[model samples]
Target: SKMFYGGVKPEMVSDKFSFTEGPSTDKEGNVYFTDQPNDKIYYWDWKTNKVIEFLNKTGRANGTHFDKDDFLITCSDDQGEIWKISKDKKVEVLFKGFEGKRLNGPNDVWNDSFGGMYFTDPLYERDYWVDFKQETP
Candidate 1:
């Protein structure tokens, strides 16, 4: 059996982000995370010990989860949509709006074993939004 370093302590990865949220990992142990205020997703390569931008202009992604197919499902708060990102970095909108009204804002997402998706929508004010206002639901 392989023994690991039991005394290892958590270390700071980076301090340059405005605000960080939604951290997930792939099967290869590569970590993916979002910086919503910056509208970017970062990739932390386990083998390289380096962090780089995986995606930019990401629609202010907040939360993310990896599906069974290894695709990345993310909450895009900028437009109240859910996005699916492929391995090739192609982005497709999964959920746009609920009924006729736009969603409040997608905060997080999860994939079930039955191939179902669950996400959270919460109303929050954004400085970039000028065309829409929050409505009572």
Candidate 2:
């Protein structure tokens, strides 16, 4: 279903990557999206119409969000880790294995006002990956 607007034409952004997910935005209206299968973060500068890769080897980063301090919080699928990336490119591992058990691969996540994180775990079978046969958290 397509909605029509008066006197407005739809424009498309240039394609740079595939498997786009984890769409988020900063205070300046710049859009951020992830290429999950490629393990990369991409940024679209709204002002200049430029797209760029923010990070590589991003732990197969999937879902992402901006924290209150504007840091990028991402669920890294490859290492099953949660990462907090500061503006100056400092990477912090917020969480790895829960109770000494590897997660089912954190699929999505969010942070509370007090910086508490709530994430989801779902079993995802990959070509080179094994089952996460651990107790659920």
Candidate 3:
């Protein structure tokens, strides 16, 4: 069930790149979103109707989820790590690798009621990579 605010209009904040990925709301209904390209997290308060940077250098954080314990879980795409953000804003890496090699990139994630988490790896190419040479025929 999707909920809607009474009269809030979605307006552009700036020409800046938001690069927003997963958006998660807290128990207080405050929404948190990621700006992966710029490596920042933003917060949109329902009561204030404002967006503010919650964190910086988020490790290219992508998908975000909140656990039953109120900890913020984020899938960091840059380093392929899942993080647990405590209430005190302390971040800890919950997972770094699955087998041995680094994951491609955590594109999205979710948590089950049974305390299990699932994530996706879809980063096939680096954002800064450039193909300067073509295959020789």
Candidate 4:
């Protein structure tokens, strides 16, 4: 098979985390994942073969995807919003809500071929949202 990640088997980088989700890979083969319970995001560097903590205080980010600009887009569910993050660790809230109502909780995100985005808003409660309430149906 000369096509497609030929025989690329899943490799376990580590088993240290409270809870983990949202694994996204960059063009450079670096893998980024989230640990919501710990409010942290980690990345596995292809060059170094190491799992490095990329950021903390992640807003309980659940799912992540890379945008056309190579920005790491994440569903910052703790705020019921989406975030666009740069390589330098700069963050910007891209979307908050729709129709004047708060989102349920953006759990995942995916980018279209044309640079548009698609995401999932599921009602996944978090410990951080102390006064939490689902504003929309």
The estimated TM-scores of all candidates read: 0.91, 0.84, 0.80, 0.90
What tens digits encode model 2's per-residue C-alpha lDDT throughout 20-125?
Answer: 8888887787888789878888888989988878888788888888887788888887767888887667889888888887776777877777877788877675
Best by TM-score: 1
* Every candidate's CA RMSD: 3.1, 2.7, 5.4, 2.4
Which wins on lDDT, candidate 1 or candidate 4?
Answer: 4
The TM-score of predicted model 2 comes to 0.84
Off by over 4 Å in 3: 1-16, 128-137
Tens digit per residue, CA lDDT, model 3, 1-137:
43558776667654555567899988899888898888888888879878877888888888998887778899886676789888667999988776665666777888877888888876556674244121211
Question: Tens digits of per-residue lDDT for model 4 on 62-133?
Answer: 899999878999998887989999989999999899898899889999987699999999886766786877
Tell how far residue 65 is off in model 2, in angstroms.
Answer: 0.4
Residue 119, candidate 1: how far off, in angstroms?
0.6
lDDT for 129 in candidate 1 is 69
lDDT of 1 at 85: 97
Write one digit per residue (lDDT tens) for candidate 1, span 1-137.
53557877677878889999999998788999998898999988989888989999888999999998899999998888899999789999997788877888899999986789999888887888668676525
Given candidate 3, what's the lDDT at residue 18?
52
